[model samples]
Target: MDTYAVHAEGLRKRYGGKDALAGFDLAVRRGTVQGLLGPNGAGKTTAVRILATLLRLDGGRATVAGLDVAKEPRAVRRRIGLAGQYAAVDQVLTGRQNLEMFGRLFHLDGRRARQRAAELLARFDLVDAADQGVEGYSGGMRRRLDLAASMILAPDVLFLDEPTTGLDPRGRGEVWDSVRALVADGTTVLLTTQYLDEADKLASQITVIDRGRAIADDTPDGLKSAVGGDRIEVVVGEAADIPRAWQVVAGVCREAPETDHGERRVHGLVHDRVAALTEAARRLRDEGVAVEDIGLRRPSLDDVFLRLTGHRTAEEKAGAAV
Candidate 1:
């Protein structure tokens, strides 16, 4: 059996006059969630399109389910399902009708289609709303219906391109549960998302893509550790106290703390989390600096992205182009 469900090497694709994917490579193990994270125009969607056989690569090679995407597109399509950024279900159709329709499109007989639809409804926790028209469904419900439609063939691999985009926290959580269930049942997943917290929560391994190429790949904790260990964050009570707090944090962490003067926040990486927090608190108290809060926190994926890419994710970047 192939150890990797998806693999690519030196994959390239060009659009208009520029390269969308320039020497990109990926290896996703079977039965695992591999996160593909990048900003808008970072070639994330292009990579997914290539792997799903929706678009051809300009150069290099890719395989899905051990079949060469370029040469065996049909065979690859048989083993993989793709869900894009939006819910693709028909609003006029009931949830069951939408799934059954997809099943028929995949060539399942009426009985088998109904059977698969029922199975999916129960599996995705959508049975209660299965009879309701998709137009009446919540954002989470619609997305769940979309996922169920993708599973009609019981594919071995699933490609989700920002599956939870535009969802509220509760809706996003609902989709997260569905993804976890799919993985538990042995589906290999390639998840592309701009939400750092979603990747941190759902992906076993994450690949950071930028400028149409992968720059980092590791488990969530591994990536975090690569940037730094825990850190002390101090929120001073007054903006005037920020400079003093920064010095105290710097003294404890033995490194200059980054300060946000507007927010009255000073934070620095630390090797000894507890000791640094203690010393910083003590020194700040001794120096008559009133602190609103002080605590130790692990480096977030956002920090890792900033360290590696030197900017915030595209959604947070002001004046970021689509």
Candidate 2:
């Protein structure tokens, strides 16, 4: 058997004149969670769909559980389960019925299906509400049920696309807990999320895509360090004061702001963050300028995205574009 649970090479997909996934490649090891992050139209969704066998790739090749996604899609489907951006469940059916139905569809015997349904209901903390119609379920409850449905077959691999979108903090935590449980059971997962924190908490490795291409791929810490070790954000009173500040702090700086937009910042790998901040403060005081806020912090996933892709995540970009 192939060592990887999922593998892709030169994966490509297009819509109209635009490329959705252009020459993308990926490898996810067994029993590991790999995160896909990118801006809007970055092809995260397209890649997930192709791997789940919902859409045929226009070019390249992929395999899940050692079964070719293109030539043996049915076999791939049999070993994999997908939970998409939206929750999918029978509104008219009770939560228990919904899971049981999926179990039956997976060819489980009636007694086994019932047993699996009960097991999932308790696992996801839906036992008390198990008999309620899905339509009456809250967004979080419905999402949990959708996840439960996907696991009826005890799939070797699972694909979760924006699993936590539209969920409150409690809801997000619930889903996170479910994913941890799945991983503990030795299941491999391929997850896509717009939330950087979600990737930080769940992904063993991360691949960032932008405009249908992989921009950066590594462990989360590796990507963060690649951008810069630590950041010192400096807020100054006047735009004219930025240059004077840079002069004192620029030697240790890998990148500094030449222009000010309300607030000016200097960020880079620094030998000592405290030393840099002290120099910045001393320079500003000599110039007779008031410093508002100055602090040292580690590079965030957002910072990495900004440096590599020249844009924020999908939601942030959408808000900015508006």
Candidate 3:
């Protein structure tokens, strides 16, 4: 049995003199969530379109579900499902009707379409509201319905392009749960998203792309560790206590702490997380420094992105616009 559901090597796509994908490569293990994390316009959607056969690659090779994408486009389409940034369901139709419509569009006969629709409605937890018009459904519900529509044929690999974009916390969580359930049932997922936390939470392995190329790829924990170790942060209650607090943290961490006077915060990296926090707290108490909050934390994905890409994802997005 093949270990990878999707594999790409030196994939390239050009848009009017600009390369949307420049030598991009990926390997997504079967039954696992592989995150393609990058800023806006980082060729994430372009890569997905290529693999889904919606767009052709200018160079390189790719295979989905063990079929060469270029040579066996039809076969690749059969084994894969794609849900883009927006929901593609009709608001005027009921959830069940929309799903059945998709089933029929996929060439299923009337009886099989209904059966598949019923099965999907139950699988996606839309049974209670299955009969209601989709216009009344919440954002999460609509996205879930979109997900169900993509699963009409129970694809082996599902490509979710920023699936939770523009969703509220609750709505994003709902979609996350749905994704979890899909992977649990042996579906491989290639999730492309700008949300760092979303990638951290859902992906087993992450490939960080920048300027249409991958710069780093690793597990969430491995990426974090690559950037640095834990950090001790202190927020002082009074602006006047900033210096004292910084000194205290610096002493505990054995390094100069970075201080933000405007925010009255001081933080520094540390090797021993618990010991640094303990000593910092004790020293702050002894020095009469009025501390608002103090804690130890590992490097976040935001920090890792900044370190690896030399800018946050938002910065990259803004730069891309100009």
Candidate 4:
């Protein structure tokens, strides 16, 4: 068996004067979820489009499910399922009809299409609502239906581009479950997501890109360590106490602390987790700084993004527009 489900080398694409993908390269192992992360306009969507055969690359060799995406577009399409950032199903169609329609589009016979739809409905837990018009479905249900439709032909590779973008927590959880179930059944997944928590929870490996270039790649814990080690964070009861709390945090950790006056929060890294947390708490008590919350925690993906890219994802999005 091929060890990789998707492979690309020095992929490049240019839009007028700007490069959308600059030397983009990636290898997704079979039967695992690989998270593709980056600030906006970092070539993630472009890479997906190229690999899915929706857009042709200017330069590079790429393959999906062992077929050259450029040379064998139809074969590649047959073996891949893509659920993009938004739900693509028609509102008038029932979930079952949507799946069946997708199956037929893939060239399945009428009976086979209905069978595939039934199977997907059960697998995605949409059997109860299978007959209901998608117009009546909640955001989560619509996403689930979109996911189900993608798998109607049980493609070998699945590309999910921010699959849970607008979902509430419950809806996100449902989509996550659907993704997990797909992976369990031996589908290789390449996921693009803005939600660090979702990627942390689902992705087996994460690759971060910036300015259309690959910047970092690692597992969730490994990526967190890139920003810093165990850090102490404390929330002061009053915004006026931010400086005092910062001083206390810096003194205890022997490192410069970051403060957010609005939240009255101060945080700094420490070589010693226990000593830092305990000492910080003791000093805050002695200084009469009322504490709202405190903890020694590892860096989150958000912190990693800011530290690596020199800006947050939201700021990156804004810059992309300008």
What TM-score fits each model?
Answer: 0.94, 0.87, 0.95, 0.90
lDDT of 3 by residue, 154-189 (tens): 999999999987899999999999999999999999
Q: Indicate the residue-level lDDT of 220 in model 2.
A: 92
In terms of lDDT, which candidate is stronger, 1 or 2? 1
Write one digit per residue (lDDT tens) for candidate 1, span 47-82. Answer: 999999999999999989999999999999999999
| Model 2 per-residue lDDT tens digits across residues 157-275 | 99999999989888899899899999899889999999888999999999999888888889999999997677666676666766766665575466653445655754445667888
Q: In angstroms, what RMSD does candidate 1 have relative to the true structure?
A: 2.2
Question: Which segments of model 1 are wrong by more than 4 Å?
Answer: 315-322
Identify the leading candidate in terms of TM-score: 3
List the global CA lDDT of all models: 0.92, 0.86, 0.92, 0.90
Screening candidate 4 with a backbone cut-off below 3 angstroms (N, C-alpha, C), the clashing residue pairs are: none
Kindly indicate the candidate among 1 and 2 with the higher TM-score: 1
Q: After best superposition, candidate 3 residue 252: deviation in angstroms?
A: 1.8
**If candidate 2 were superposed on the true structure by all CA atoms, what would the RMSD be?**
2.8
lDDT of 2: 0.86
